[model samples]
Target: MTDQAHHETTAPASVLIVDDSRVSGRKLAKAVTALGHRTELVSGGTEALGILGEMPFDIVLLDIVMPEMDGYAVLIAMKADVALREIPVIVVSSLDDEIESVARSIELGAEDFLPKNFEPAILRARMNASLARKRFRDRELDYLRDIDTLTEAAQVIEGGAFHPTELNLASVAARDDPLGRLAKIFRSLAEEIYDRERRADLTVRTLRGTLLVIAAGSIFGIAPALGRLASAREIPPLGLAFWSAVVAAILCLSFSIGRSGLPRLKLRDLRFLTLWALLLGCLYQLLTVVIAAHVEASLIAMIGSSRGFMVFLLAALLALERPSLQRFSGLGLGFAAVAVVLLVQGTGEDNDLLWIACALVLPFLLSLHTLLMSWRPRHLGAATTVGIMMALSALFLLPFAVAQNALFLPSLSFGQRELITLALGASTAAALVLALDLVVTAGPVFSSQMAYSQTLAGIAWGMLLLGERLSPLAWGALVFVIAGFWLVKPKRAGDDFRITLRMKGNG
Candidate 1:
């Protein structure tokens, strides 16, 4: 490798190394300094944050499991800052293989991750890579900012006359090959159209698949509830409540399938995720079957659905996409409010425990689904892959449904039949609403705001149609959820709150 000092020193890149280990910090500092770059060593994230406030650094080397403020908290703080958010952070920690932790770091806007035990060469390489990436990103930003100027200059002479005429005359005088020029123009146009069409097709397929998965999964969740309602021959007091856990699970799965395809298999690209999905899918089915044999169907369904959330969380962690804490917190708050409403209204002894279990598992499954969808293979059509996966899941569940006689068709009066069908239809319809909502509010809007809106809508609908009452706890939960989401709103320069990084670095 070339000496760091030998590289151009027009603007010496700055690096801050934050670690609890004095030895590691000093070593990293030395390595960075050797490259003719300015380096600072801080013992912990708090110190690093303090330094960040005083001086701007081009990159940060963070340790994951630090004292007081861990790498995650620090990264979050950095991203929250307008000045620091632009600086690329490389996580240097021992928790390299800890997939969840790594994924969380990435989600928190960390640019890269590295292990503490990395070889000197690897360390040097990583540092250089980080700096290079930052430079490229800066260059792209600058280019975009001055694109009009660049375009105008390229097209016009100093006096603002078109340069194309002069270039054409010169080309003619030189007798340049016309066929070669025509071929180049045709090739460029074809390539552009091909790229646009490919993107459009992928988007269309992903959306269609997302809708189908939600519909199918909802049918799976609601079918059992409908059967039970028919068996009991009573108006299910908690129609939405009974279906909530299942709806949540189907929603999480739909989100995952929509964001990522069901049949998405990338052995070389996040193999851990593929393994996790396969393992979780099996575990979920096994657990559902075992639990169904011993427990009430509703309880089994609730617990099973909750477990699916946990799987979703694992998937998100593995995918390395940052969880919108605001969004998650909002979801949590909304659930809490719903819980309060249920408790005030619920008469059953076992209902609370089942609900709690379902709530606990919801975030994990949601995260998992989000992560899986984010990394869906470009080659596979999203709708087709999702359809296949849902079909497979149905096939897998068929045996359990059959053995338990959960497959029994219920004879019903007109109203009961209508309720059952509505429940089934609602699940699918809700999934479509969710996908549309995601597309609409993806950037800038506080997760809490979205949650608050959803909570209000649910409460309003319940009150108007079902005559359901919201207790004080529901209101309290709503307040907390909204407040949390507002607090996490991204602090950036522009009004646009989208968190996209410069893609040109990899290019």
Candidate 2:
């Protein structure tokens, strides 16, 4: 029992004994050391304060009266500062018998009063009690500080600057609190969110590349048939545009099941979708075909090729797509190709410029359609959007076609001219529009290359059906198109471009 009691009382604590008299200070130090506590003796308050600043002590044994700096002064200084305020001070004074003196000392932050002839047993109890309280306070201070750190971390997360491993998890390893677990949960959540965003971004890039390739090929297949229909017949551009949209819409609309329906769209989205349909699907289509009737079909296709670059520029300006040196170079080369074609074999200076001006409008309209697709709700599936645009195009053209007397029959009967429009519209235009949905996602510079493919078909059709021919410079312009392709195809994956469109070199 005696040994256990001694063990309990003797847990080592560093104590500071401050007195001006050497004898008093040594006596207190010796008693504290005998009690199995470590002690340091200081002759004045200034020395005690300096030692306390350098080391951590559980208690300070101070005298009320000293030569220069007194115990009362030391206590006042300690209480004034937060770091030293917690060290328990027991003033050693005969004045402990005076109630007012003890009260004054206690009020100045002394933990207890010690008589000049202090009893070892009483001293042991008072010192040990003060030591126990100080240790508890220390843990609480640490815990509170850790909580403050967590608050700062929360602010950082809210500001969207969260770093996955920013927090020192080890700080809480020994802690038994809910906040530690909370910190770990937040860390996990942040990582998961960032990872998901990364994956989604990759998916969009890949999907965009794929769409551009399809649009490129699809546009080529139909331009020849379109040139054949537009030139050999008297159908107005409005009628041709409307009929093509009608045929394409019938094909695309069939695929909208299981996806979000167009009917469910909000009023604003529905209205904009209609406007988009008119601008690109109806009005732009009419203008391109009308212009194609006058200009050489291959030249029209070449001029229309600039649509991709136009969209690229718009997207970059809107902060939707990043600008790159390769993309700019490709676009620059493409325009130079357009200028080359116009300069070398332009029909008549005034006529060529006029027709080219009309063709230029088509690509700008196409750019708007691309932007709308990006801005549109994703749940409105690509097929549905295409179907909606085409349906509206056909409706828009109905009145115009009737006024021009240009619908269903070129002469109210299925002739070669009328048959070509049906085939062009149903098979080629439908496929082109469907492919266009993908092209919009792919991006402008990539999608514009479709015009390059169209140039080849336009040349072939113009030769076979309309006896058109490309000038020698037109052939060289095609090579620039190839250079443009190489410039834009990124070399690596997840480097902001994943699935790549290596446009099959024109056969």
The per-candidate count of clashes, in order, stands at: 12, 2
- How close to the true structure is residue 382 of candidate 2, measured as C-alpha lDDT? 63
Q: Which parts of model 1 are misplaced by more than 4 Å?
A: 1-359, 378-386, 409-422, 425-469, 472-480, 489-507
lDDT digits (tens) for residues 1-507 of candidate 1: 345333523247888889899888888788777767888888888889999999988889899988799999999999999878989898987873667777888999988878877776776677777777777677567545444443343343333322232223222223235533543453354345445554554454444433333333333443333434443554332222223223334554566677765745555633533443343333332332232222334333223223222432453456432455654564455445445554564533544555445433432433344334444444544333333333344444456556654443434664654565356434433442343333232321221123233334444433443344555564565465444434433212222212122233344
**All predictions: root-mean-square deviation over Cα?**
25.4, 12.9
Model 2 global lDDT (CA atoms, 0 to 1): 0.68
The C-alpha stretches of model 2 lying farther than 4 A from their native spots are 1-211, 214-221, 224-228, 258-263, 337-352, 409-414, 427-441, 471-483, 489-507
TM-score of 1: 0.34
Q: After superposition, how far is residue 141 of candidate 2 from its true place, in Å?
A: 12
